[model samples]
Target chain A: MISSIFPSKNFFCLNKLSVCSDSFHLNTSLFYNEYSVILTFLFIATILSVIIILFSYILAVQNPETEKLSTYECGFEPYEDARHTFDVKFYLVAILFIVFDIETMFLIPWTNVLGQLDLVGFWSMIDFMFELSIGYVYIYCIGALDIH
Target chain B: MIVLIICIVLKILVVVVPLLISVAYFTIAERKIMGIIQRRKGPNVIGFLGLLQPLADGLKLFVKETIFPSNSNIIIFLIAPMLTFILSLIGWAVLPLSKQIVLSDLNIGVLYLFATSSLSVYGIIMAGWSSNSKYPFLGALRSAAQMISYEVSIGFIIINVCICAGSFNLSFIVLAQNNVWFVVPLLPMFFIFCVSMLAETNRHPFDLPEAEAELVSGYNVEYSAMTFALFFLGEYANMLLMSAFVSILFLGGWLPLVNLFPFNYLPGSLWFSLKLVLGVIFFIVTRATLPRYRYDQLMYIGWKSFLPLSLGYLLLSVGILISFNWLPT
Candidate 1:
């Protein structure tokens, strides 16, 4: 009863027929080909890495001079570990630079489109510039950009 | 589908290659700009007008050995700069240089950009943590805090623009400014956004994360050779992206300037590119002109000043929209 209902022979024959088809074989090859692109990229990347390493080894120098190996600071005797905490002013100045820098950055595109905008764009930019100038004044009053 | 793929490939190549080249020259531009500001010559011997200097620097970095510290997490150290570099590039996908030239015009393009920019902080964090060094770790922490804080104000500023334009689509936002750019009604918000972008990008003054006199090159202190180059590229790319955002949001993306003379015939993309270059020059100028900020002061500016100002601008825009019957009710 089980053998009559299962039809295992027919299933096996169908599987064999499907496997033997040229389209199925071609499909498998296509799958392999797609995988090979990624494989090729990885292979190329690895080769490049090896070549760079080998090249660097040829040019790499070894210097025992204590000064040469020390953390760089304009040839002045490098005082203190690089991790030693320094003035907060340096960070402040950097932040202020970015703020004003970005403000001016925004003005450029507005200026480009200003002519087509007529009085509207012109006045708009004036207003924007005016507002930005306030921040500039504030920053200046605090002396954020002052390097000394 | 095939055409779309080709278009995408071409767009990526066009944007990425020129962007890489520009980033390289930006280093030279920065030096030259600084020199001019400080009254000295900068890097003149490498080539004509020091044009070949960036190439020489690239070669030097390429030849240099990448030293992975024994105590460092090698996998994360490798992945951090790549992450930052890739994220920096991702923002360009949405920016419309001309009417038809954008890579992807997602409806929520602005939000998508903000999301991508936010993810970049993780790269900084990973770089600091994976290095197993104290300065980088501190730098990363400062960067993470600064970025997250300023992002809120930036988000609020963007919301003000959205309120005014009544769209999240970047192209739509630009089109909404057909008669006038939002820079007029949203001047205050635009101002806040600019400051926020500066802090967001960790540019000078806000560069506490990589303070040379303090953190010794910050998160990428452990990085060298091409690995370091990727981070440098990512930074300049981020600068470009921020500039692009300003162009798109407030300035009107790719919209021709008021049909003046020969300028009308010039493509919108050329205008956008010109704007971007001007933005780079502005970045350099600021670097020349300004000093860095104290950490606490940075926080104060973001939270105390810019945040409140942005919130006020957002409220003001909303009030105007509602009063003008622009709202759907």
Candidate 2:
């Protein structure tokens, strides 16, 4: 019955008090020390930044006015919606960037293995680059790369 | 466990206090330097030589009112600055000040740094979008696009360094620079990295996103009081973080100019700080010296020039390393 819920040997049911206790009791000192330092820093940093901001918030004046909160449009009221649809050109460039950025991510691990692959790996990357160049050229020719 | 926790907290306080103090002084330094460049006295009235100006500024900003923009996304409006402030501070955790100093020496320190920098974009975007104002919305959009563009080249440059160092750990990158700094071989990459860093931090001449003449302070236009202060602090902290990155990647981290006699006698952290200060000065100088680029030109440099140059350099470095059999084992 107990085994049905906890299929993996690594997964111990809390109902099995002795088994759970032993596994949980295993040494955590080494891992704990380094992580604790990070945790402490994060905790303190968060607290410090929060305290300063909160202190200011508490001490500062709270005078909300219709004029004060209104969006600044050269002192005239905003004429159009702030969230108007942006240029499609930005999307085009962004998509192109995403493709190349992902390519860089792939290249990182390949660098680590360059010793073993030798000339074969180099040529493979060249092949990859050739394909990338084709897409880049296509983008250039179409003027997708051009910022209007 | 409790005692250990206390010890960790104390260790953190040591790094935090100095960092906070430096962030304050960085603003003062920028003003003073910019003032001198313009041939004027700057901020000298507060405390002997304007030493207390930042504190006074902090006080003034704190006591001022925080105006919640009508019809804005109130929750996100409030969260944006705090997000920026906290994200900027956290990147220092994995940074190696010296062989002995670091908050946590994570194995994937480079990735950690990348993650934090990338996440900082969200804070800016959130600030801009939440303001429900036209100028900030446009500013936010520009910043997002600009950051994403530059990050590509920055990523490649870092990977190039990691390839030479044979580890993702930043300290190892520094150690790799012991014999000859990466800057000497990767001089072009260094310049590209510096320019990209300038854009990444939204400093001039790449500061189109916040072109005050056009955008009226951009994303932080609607922010005020402590909220504004948080954004201000966060931006300066990020500038310092980027300076640290330049130092660590190209200038041999905390190592002395030469590991000989008097130079070697200087503490590694001291050398690290000296290099960082120089980088900060360069950042301030660039701000004073250059005119802001047009928005399109900013994108052109990032995508057309930097992206291709860094990518091509990566390929060339790989080719050379293979031919010379200099690939790190």
Clashes of each: 22, 0
Model 1 misplacement above 4 A: A1-148, B1-7, B327-329
If you superpose only chain B onto the true chain B, what TM-score does each candidate give? 0.96, 0.99
Candidate 2 regions with alpha-carbon error over 4 angstroms: A1-36, A116-118
lDDT of each: 0.69, 0.83
- Model 2, B172-220: lDDT tens digits are 7888899999999899999999999999999989988899898999899
lDDT score, candidate 2, position B28:
96
Provide DockQ values for all models, in the order shown.
Answer: 0.05, 0.32
Docking class of 2: acceptable
Question: lDDT: which candidate is best?
Answer: 2
Best model per TM-score:
2
| Tens digit per residue, CA lDDT, model 1, B1-329 | 67644544555567666777888888999999899889999989988999999999988887776666655688887778777887887677677888877655555567778887988989998988887667777788788778877886787677667656655668878887778887777777777777788889999868888888887888887777777877887888899899889878888777766767787788988888887776788778877888899887787787567855775565555445445656421
Q: Give each prediction's root-mean-square deviation over alpha carbons.
A: 14.9, 6.9
